[model samples]
Target: MSTPHTRRSFIGHAAAGFSTLALPRWGQAQPATEPAPRPAQIEHAVTAPVAIEVNARPIPAFEPRDRSRTRFGSLQYRSGLVLTSPHRGFGGLSGIRVDAKGERFLALSDQGSWFTGSIRYSGRAMVGLDDVEAAPMLNAEGRPITEKRLWYDTESLARDGNLVYVGLERVNQIMRFDFSKGGTRARGEVLPTPPAVRKLPYNKGLEALVFVPKGQPLAGTLIAFSERGLDANENLIAFLIGGPSPGQFSVRRTEKFDISDAVLLASGELLILERKFSWFTGIDIRIRSIPLKSIAPGALVDGPVLFNADLGHEVDNMEGIDAHVTAEGETVLTMISDDNFSLLQRTLLLQFTLVE
Candidate 1:
């Protein structure tokens, strides 16, 4: 009885190999530091990524006693829309909108003590939460903010709607939450990481936020953080405008080109999503695309596997990606996964159509 489009084609065909992740004993105590600074001009061009065609369908999701564990790491996209959260949950569904108002909104973020509710999208569409509240205790800049600091992953929502950039990751800082400042606790202000990534070591937070479009000469909004570790030597850093305030971020290095589910690909390019599990072989995931001027920081290119799900195709933990247009004009890519509530792990939504 599978049918979420056949469990996303069984997660793109049962899954296979691409292993190389080993660096998380608890974090901290591994920072020789020295790799950051690449991209003088970078004009390399060599497209590959062209093998994603899973429509077998059937993804209801459930398979997480411990398939590795990772509910939500980072993701945010606006207008065309996308948002998520679940690595640990006090508040489950964080944000996800694919508007014109066709309807797709599942928002919440109170993980400080877990009291989220009011997530709607069921009837069979999937995405279900309830209506919880009572977990917010914000005060910052005035004190009284006891723990439950929110630990937020990363978020962005400010083309000009009135700011919404969150990245507390336990408190390295990157606030900005002022939904017009009416009241929701409002307290967003920090913004400035880059003393060589705040000095590295354990401060390891910040996952994803892409805004790009402030003024030129070098505008702003292109954060992308996730040093989780596994390859490319580590240090997946990139920050240009940054905003909020602290020292004003500007670090760099992204040309190493590895695979870890990066985003921001409206033809501007730079899409990386990967996951491959193994018990013997029972999970698969892939999505790749690069062209952000070929990438700069550290400049070390080599990504072109594109799609290879045991060769058949199947997708499960393929977390976040956005770039919609469709109606004939063409150009659609919507993917989401982060069901760490663990029944087995399933909360996926994938749709692709971009080839040029």
Candidate 2:
């Protein structure tokens, strides 16, 4: 562990060493000018899977001002990385799924692209990445999903064995892919969803997904959560699809946070990763642990906040979360950020140990 003085000294030296680097400050004020027209969305249509080089810079401490204090809420800081890639299509990572062994990872950008890679670890601390590849998400006809209008914005991801489910926010639809067929090359078919799902508010719909595996409380269920789709009672609307009790439920929304991603733990806990942006405070991210058994048709579920962080911490647009148990029986939570392809934002990958 790094001490505050040492960390500060190292950072000062690093700043001096890299003073010429043009990285944008997170919340610096911009010069006022006439608003520019929004540019057309960049399409990351890859003909096939292609390897990409990504650079990872180690973040020695989560809270730079107090490096020695590792414990925060119900988690203990482990390691983190500030990830960057020269590839133009490399950001906007909305969701991620890590293998059980905490090695291989599958991630997707909101621009309808797949990023597959493995985490290189040195004694449980992430060193960097290896074997990273980028590919466009394909549709039923083997064409890039982004080739269609309003078919991108792939925000949430869930995995059950070789089967993968992705939730697209722009169209409020779910697409299924079988990795066994061709890995990221597998074409996605639109999964049938309830009529209400298509009625969710565009851009705010279908932000988080968790697939309950066999032997779980809601086994064989695809749990979907909207970013801010609210019910008449003002709670966030969620759905249980293809489960024994397939219906709609509500997640009690508080603190102005919206759902970004979620992971269902083997311990019967549903951890929802949420974030909220404010001009006054920048951005804030949090994790709430709700019991899996408490969710059912028409049930209103709520949980205790397990963690929270703000811009004062080394955070950006924190968007994705996943967990894997280490050999020592420690549940390690991994988080990734979506830069929104903006110079002022960054893509951060952070990890923590869930201290039960």
Q: Backbone collision count in every prediction?
A: 35, 0
Expressed as tens digits, the lDDT of each residue in 1-60 for candidate 2 is: 544433333343234323332211111233468453333212222346778899999989
Scored against the true structure, residue 142 in model 1 reaches a CA lDDT of 24
Best by TM-score: 2
State the weakest 10-residue window (summed lDDT) of model 1.
42-51
- Look at candidate 1 and tell me the lDDT of residue 320: 47
**Candidate 2 segments exceeding 4 Å error:** 1-45
Per-residue CA lDDT of candidate 1, range 1-356, in tens?
A: 44454454444333312322121111123345955333321111001111111212333322223333222212211111122333223212222334322233222231322122332444323243333332232345422133333344332222224455544444545555564763334554665656554443343444444454444212354554543322234434444444432222222234332233455544565565555555545455555555555444444433454443321322454544545464566555555554433343344554444555
Tell me, what's the RMSD of every candidate?
21.7, 9.2
lDDT of 1: 0.38
lDDT of each: 0.38, 0.85
| Candidate 1 C-alpha error for residue 313, in Å | 7.1
